[model samples]
Target: MTPPVPPARLLVVDDDKGILPVIERVARALGFDVQFRDNGREAIDGLEELDPDVALVDLQMPGLNGLDVLRAMRDADPDCRVILMTGNPTIDTAVQAVQGGALDYLEKPFDFDRLRRLLAGVRDGIERREALLQADASVAQRVEFHGMIGRSPEMQQVFDAITRYAPHVRTVLVTGETGTGKELVAKALHAVGRRHARRFLTVNCSAVVETLFESELFGHVRGAFTGASDTKVGVFEHADGGTLFLDEVGELPLTLQPKLLRAVENGEVQRVGSLDTRKVDVSVIAATNRDLKADAGAGRFRSDLYYRLSIIEIHLPPLRDRREDIPYLTAAFVREFAARVGRPITGVTTAAELLLQRAPWPGNVRELRNVVERACILSDGRMLTDRDLASAMAISGQAAASAPPMLPFDEADDADPNLLSTVQRDQIQRVLLDTGGNKAKAARVLGVSRRSLYRWIERLHLEA
Candidate 1:
């Protein structure tokens, strides 16, 4: 089953009669189960009873002001995201609300698109905070490899595949790009399988020199080579009666393919510089970033070996491919690095998350980790500001720190942009610029049908 959104319980508090239904409609549309309150007193009572993931309050409320409501809500639970809403907002008020521990402040006549963006950032912040708590192994293991983070159906399918293959003592092949955590999947399979108690030895095929591959996989007798002073067992012997982890298996040389295939077929090994053939029982788990079949067809790898290793195969989606997992993973990484580095960096600020979601992370999770670590080191206190993230991302020409967006709102017409519309505008503009006015090229660049791009162009109002 897919994981539900972490923040289902939400309370919307505003004094104006018009505010309640709009808040309710927006919150409900965003899949939040919302409770509405007319003023601060009712909001406090509702918050105490409901204990929501977030509380949206108006700064000007009858009796106990919005600040009072925020103070009360936070005093009850410091974690709840309290966003202050106001019309005719001022710089002084924004500073006060932020300093007073409000998650963020939104202007009146909600920018639904911006509001949605804020909620996403709030969810990310909550994840990062929780991840920090989880980083304490003593606390609990909150992040797991299979279906632990994302709500997408693809991830659920991957989870199901892992569950199905975790039991048997067969060799499994895991294929994925770097930073997708193929090793994590291997470990999970071993941990969840019947061989949980046995050793899980890992060997990086690419790290081994061509001459040392055999010696590393099979035991080397004394005087096997210049460096072999004494008898040393190889990974196969060491992992006997257990599991052997072969990372970057696609890097294994063609000359050793026959030997590896032999070992797998016979369940035994032959020591180097010795006429000894030893019988050893071991299960193999292999991981690779290359297309093994293509490599085999190109004579880079052995087809027979590929089939043997791939009795069960699992492909992990890249971080960008599984965009739903970024917030979860980014949150986890931030918490972990902050605690390790002894920084109170509690969460990524709203602008930081916007930059993250908008960028194309070519380097995947590893790059994200580095960014989080850099942010952790640069951050001063409990939150990671947009500035902390800016230098690390290397997006060469980022926008100015703070400026009103170019898109003007029609407040008089009640035309608030939604996420889909915002995305369409962004896509159209991005593709148009990339294609240099060639609509066909723009459609291909966007991975959308030409007709779809044309429709988007018409909808978003384009110059090209």
Candidate 2:
């Protein structure tokens, strides 16, 4: 047999020549191919040639420092893992490095055991990413999961639900506000799962005419209707053995609900003219902005149909609610559409991000994606500027202006307060003014809501 494959490669870079040998010994002993560098800059150049599975970088270097190397490594290969070794390690610096995507940082004279563990963790992470990439390549090599991006905690929950439910060949209902990417989610559900091998169909229920609803959905025999001269197969028949996504299902006419329900329940449909009932296996995925439960309660929707369609429910939170994930999502969308539209756009600028953070994306992710796409297509270079977002932000600002001031009032404070209290009140006013005075939005930015937000605003007695 041929020689066994070598262990995974690990790159170790530092200025100290002696430390290089120690790390090499440790890494080789641990079954990793070790590469060394005398300085951070050289390490990075070597990184380009070596493509090491993981990198161990020192914090202190003459020309290019450890932190600098970490930054460069991340900029070059976002997926690369950089473990920082620092002689003068501080909590703030350590936190900054990790936040900047450095895998882990090791203090000078760090326990070799701890270093090894961190390296192993990085290796595992890289392996998992590679596996996912391989799977994607095997499928369609596209990065987007529907219109959604980011593997954050909240989005991951949505993705896991999509994966588990998409392959079942059952009806699904996705409920979310406008611009929340309900359609993208439906497409993603179709892209994978059991329906991957078959046709995936879509129709916007709200856009269809009630008069043609039956004909459009169930098809028609030749010369069966006023517009029909030839035979036509309904979406159900076309999507047989595949997925049929009904977006905005809540907007479908009340009259059409029964027929839609019948087809879903029995997997049988009758053409507008043909007397015979044809059976078709069509997996349905529905989405709506309206509250289906309330609609059912109001007798607008069939309760039985609601139960049948809601076997899998995906509720997408508004963008503002998941503000923490905005940066990642924005970056992803920028990269994607920029590449697709053949533009030079690289990413959202910091100031643009500040505007994004403050503005209310009432339209949710759909609006954000549109804004980014526009910016990407129009931008001259890699960076999306604040100017690109000016129009949207102006509209958001006008909306903010019209909305009632979200000020917190204290019942007791309204009656009376001391001079010291007034000073506290002034400070709160300043904070509110700095944060645009939208209490609910400000509260999120300040990490306080419910009781504390109003108290501070009320205490300050400011128009926040």
Candidate 3:
């Protein structure tokens, strides 16, 4: 059942006590829960407690004028709509009011009709935004595809491609930026494919050492290398008649490309330091954040291997390009984290949703999920306000700001450390410890890629 929308809050700060009654009547008629302050000082003091959706302040006050109240209100709640009123109006003060983030400036002598219209407009806007948020919450539940929630046309296309190719494709490539859920898409393909009942193995190509690439993909005979103490069955053999998801495949060593290509092409793999070739029927799903085509053009990757892996390519769009999906994603994340934490957080307020929609989600869905998770943890009420989301985003921004410059993990130790680097190191260590040395869980909590977390661990010289 849908809950009733709360009344829009309106705060009126005017020195004249006589005008308070007039404003209250009009505001209450517009369905506003109204509060009155005799001066700006009192308004500013109570601003945090009232947390009004709209504020009407008189320009002329003894101390801390309307402009002062507006600034305080903005600092307290940026989403609040402010309207300034004054009897002795000037062009300069009017300009200052507008520039100070006033929704509108009104001349006094009480144009009751104009005031009524303004109040009604604010009420209608608040109600409309509330309605949209409710609609988004409903749509979020309906538009889920597998574990991913998106209604954007780009995501819809990707879903269609997965449905069409999963049943038959042998080799597929999923491409997108980090945190765009390439791995999820790979899992979705495997789940719907003919090999659904078989083992679905995943190998993070970047995480594996270059020397172990061949042995990891194709089994190694005992005594093949210094650490080849036993004849180990590789992923290719273990996942025979199943799916092998190679994440960050662009990070695979150039020397091993031919062997990988052969495994994809002829379903054949040769164990390291062995003469015989083993035929294994394994479906490969390769995912990478880098453009393999561009890398091939630059001679950084083999063209033949790239072509073999990209028989059916699926590209996932970034979150910024799909802004319309932000609300739905937020709703889903809120519900998920709230349930996981056993909180009663119904959803984010309309203002909070607006803030999320405007955010530049560089980390894409993962970053959004992290923020929502953090907000859910911080919130103690049924609805998450803008303040909750803002605090979470601020923490994220601080961590991002303290991050060291991007360098290869192998060379990270050589870079000089600074104060910001120290802060980042401490934060990573704390999260790692909190997650009990689980790099994957820490990465999700920190809103970073596992590869990035690994690099930070190396760069910061942490025990994890």
Highest TM-score scorer: 3
In order, the Cα lDDT scores of the candidates are 0.72, 0.71, 0.81
User: lDDT tens digits, residues 330-397, model 3?
Assistant: 77788889999998887777567667767777899999999999999999999788889889988777
Query: Which residue runs does candidate 2 get wrong by more than 4 Å?
Result: 1-147, 340-343, 377-382, 395-464
Clashing pairs in 2: 59-66, 346-382, 425-460
Which is better, 2 or 3, measured by lDDT? 3
TM per prediction: 0.55, 0.56, 0.57
Runs of candidate 1 exceeding 4 Å displacement: 1-143, 146-151, 395-464
| Candidate 3 weakest lDDT stretch, 10 residues | 406-415
Alpha-carbon runs more than 4 Å astray in model 3: 1-142, 398-464
TM-score leaderboard ranking: 3, 2, 1
Residues 1-464, candidate 1, lDDT per residue (tens digit)? 11122455678887777877766776777667787788898777655356677888899877998889989887765657799999969999899899889989999888988888777676566566544433432332223454244433455567767778888656899998887778888888887888779999999999999998899999799998998999988889998878888999999988888888877878878888889889988888899999998998887899999989888899888766666455556677776887899877656765666666655666666777788788788778786777787777763333333432232111111111211223235556866887566554565566653334444555445676
